[model samples]
Target: MEFWIIVALTSVIVTLAVAWPLLRAPKKSTELTDDYDMRVYRDQLSEVDHDLARGVLSEEEAKQVRTEVSRRVLAADASASTSAAEIRIDSSRKTNLTALAVMAVFLLGGASGTYYLIGSAGTADQPLAQRLSALQTARDNRLSQKEVETRVGNITEMEDKATDDYKKLVAKLREAVKQRPDDLRGLNFLVQNEARLGRFAAAHQAKSRAITISGSKATGTDYTDLAELMIIAAGGYVSPEAEAALAQAFAKDPEDPRARYYSGLDLAQNGRADIAYKVWINLLDEGPEDAPWIAPIRGQIADVALMAGIRLAPPPPLAGPTADQIKNAANMSEKDRRKLINGMVRQLSERLASGGGTADEWARLIRAYGVLGETEKAKKIWGEAKLKFASNAKGLGLIKEAATSAGVAD
Candidate 1:
């Protein structure tokens, strides 16, 4: 009602402003101009008479001047009469009342009609505080891990297509872990296999047990892994349980890349895109290109940036293992593959040691050694990287991610 009142008042004011001039009586400008000309010509005629009387002009010259002035006076009188007739005719005609009425109607009615058709006529204003409060409420009421898992049923659609041999192997691993619950190695193996089989709930349970067994020795990576598994189990939702695990991971290591990435995701999910954009952008800048979290961050950061009202250029593609290399590794015998990977790792290590590669390269080397089960080598390279990038915060962050993945950093 208030909106309509304001709109109606504005339309009326604008219409009156525009139509005010047209609504007034027309001016007698033509008549006034003719009258002034007639008066001037009459004065000229009188001057001609005076000149004749003062002997300043010949009789014939005076007569000629008088005739010319008289003719001009007559012409002015005729013009004034014509102008008066035109004015009388104009007065007889109708005023612009109809046109003014049409204008007012168009201005008021057209605006109201258009607004009624397209505008949010009855909606209330959503102030910033209200919007933020609503988002906070949504975040508070978001589904829990179990609830989300229940909503996203049949999480193993793809895993159900696994070959008989793979299924049997996973079953055997599950039984082994069940029998040797305290064996961290078996538990780790069970978590990996369960995740591969799309049994993320089981994987997270195994990971939780592993974290409990390690107790004070558990790293941020361990908690991050558990959080990641919970997210996967919930079909990518960062549920409350997953958020708690992520909080634990952050408590362990603030710069843990996986934990930080998931934290950003949680923020984004909860409608805090501004903070999420900053978090993800820092992660992108401080990156080992092959970090597991890097790909997803790259994929979604542009959208998050838009939500945060930032215009972000798409990041350059990351350099990583090629499809052909991955396919080749899949075909290689385990021994041969290990030899190939070891050769590659040796080359990278030598290059970094001799040429002092970028932080990304140093981080990659650390991750590679970790994957090769060379914890001592990974730790040594991590130490060297920390010294090499001592003053560089971004470089140190990247190196820390690799170190975390390699179990060489807290």
Candidate 2:
């Protein structure tokens, strides 16, 4: 009977010990009072001020003495407040708690030993499930702690690697551009780095060289990428060339949303509100059917239309792709495409010369020069085009002629 009682008591104690941690509120020491020393210092400061005003010291001596006292008071105040409240509370309370806890542990241990020696001669077996549950809980806690540590370490390593690689890439790009001043690839890399670092103006300057290199033969990818970067660099300020490039790229691959959308933006930037409106109208009419780009394109078209004083109806149903549209104008029988493109160039140039050109029109002139391989002349004309035609009606009309010429079906 004694042994049975002992076993029951042992089980109860074991159960309580296991249950205590789960049921107990976490132990937290109270926050400590801040600035006890500051309170004393403040009292001392009041005393010094009183003494000074009462003529206990001459004014000059009081001033000097007050300065030194003030310094000491502030130092004492800072010292009292610097340690965190939580740390101070833990230091003060843990000492007392530790002593009581040690006493309780020894008492409990003694009672357990006495019961085992005198009251129960046989071992009290625990259920396998309970024992397994305890073991699993302990294992899970250890694994969770280890996993957190591992993940933190990995994140730290990744951060260090990223920083180092970024620096190396920047250095390599600079060196490459310096070695080969005309290297578009190097300039592109530098531009990419500048953009990443948010040095947008610098990126634009670097990207300009790449744009010049791309010239008339700029691939669709090249034109689109450069235009996007240029806008970001300028915080959306663009020249006629940027808009023209965007338009030409769209004419080549109307299916590309980014090219089509930014082409409208470029037009608006260079002060060709009318042509921009029309370009957007065409974009909305001709863009990929049911594409995500349609809404924004429509929105931009509406805005530009408002500015251009052009009331646009809903865009017309898109015409199906024509063979002329699909065939590369550049690849056409050299005689045929060249004749068409040349006729466009001559007719547009004459029109612009008769009056002036729009930003879009200027872009068309540049495109004509690019297609004709007269890059330097194209450049000279583009530079002068904008300054000459701020808002002349003839200038915009000329630009419309240029657009029609450059964007003609193969």
Best by TM-score: 1
Q: What overall lDDT goes with each candidate model?
A: 0.81, 0.59
Pairs of colliding residues, candidate 2: none
User: Per-residue lDDT for 344-369 in model 2, tens only?
Assistant: 67767765554333355466677678
True-vs-predicted CA distance for residue 389, candidate 2, Å: 28
Once fitted onto the true fold, the runs of candidate 2 whose alpha carbons sit more than 4 angstroms away are 1-168, 182-184, 211-217, 241-260, 269-274, 289-299, 308-410
Query: In candidate 2, where is summed lDDT lowest over 10 consecutive residues?
Result: 152-161
Clashing residue pairs in candidate 1, if any? Answer: none
Per-residue error for 15 in candidate 2, Å, reads 99
Model 2: lDDT to the true structure: 0.59
- Note each model's CA RMSD in angstroms: 13.3, 34.1
